[model samples]
Target: MTVDDIDQELLRLLSADGRRTFSEMAGEVGLSVAAVKRRVDRLREIGVITGFTVKVDHTKLGWGIEAFTELRYAGATPVSAIITSAFAVPEVQAVYAIAGDPDALVHLRVRDIRHLQQAIDRMRRTGPVVGTKTLMVLGSWNRDDPAPGPVSDER
Candidate 1:
């Protein structure tokens, strides 16, 4: 469970490109392919590396509208109930347990403004959600094509 420098390096490489061959990663990290594979498998086993998948641009997929909704619930609400309500709607992509005025923050994607409104309405109708404030997303970007945090000589 203790991740060493080599393990961090392997994680960084895989985060950049999950499909990168172990041999290719070996060249970058100065390890044998088998060694890299072992580290990666261990990373998975220990839950450091969970699962890999393709990233898609939601806008390009006709989901042109995105929104961040801050949900307010009555006093001392359980987070599991909040998550369950959000996940029941397919438009909800990510849920954040917030620390401020709002009980939770949710990132949602929809085909258009109408769809966004519908998703918000659905969340509001959920039993424990007292209220919600939604903010429209203008644009976004990702740097994960080459993920940060290199395993430098600091190890």
Candidate 2:
């Protein structure tokens, strides 16, 4: 699906706030509400727009501790299975099959250090997990650049 200017505009507005009504999006994108709806449906059908979700504040929810765990597997273990098992745990936010020394990397959110330790213990028992290195996130700094504009002057 080739997204034109209007489609891109609709995506930008929707990405920032998915709750925006089709009428409101139409006004912003200078298209009819029906047109906007059609484009949105097309985007979904083509797998451009996945799903809309609310961003929860983990700190407010009493899950203040964030940690990244690097896991190394013992000889020739299936890393995908390990990642799937780790993600099955509620505390695990994200999992990645990585290269280099570590076989997988897991991002976790927990209530505290004790909770993190318990989760780690469960993960170690899952399979051929050889070792794990954990790094506690003390604070997070916003480092993402602004989203790309409609067209680039450099191009």
> Mind giving the per-residue lDDT tens digits that candidate 2 earns over 1-155?
59898888888888777899999999888889999999999999999999897767799989999999988888887766877778767889998988778988999999999999999998888878899999999766442224555754565
Every candidate's lDDT? 0.87, 0.86
> Candidate 2: how large is its RMSD?
6.6
**In terms of lDDT, which candidate is strongest?**
1
Model 2 TM-score (2 dp) = 0.83
Best by TM-score: 1
Q: After superposing candidate 1, which stretches have Cα over 4 Å from the reference?
A: 142-155
Query: What does the lDDT read for residue 11 in candidate 2?
Result: 83
TM-score against truth, every candidate: 0.85, 0.83
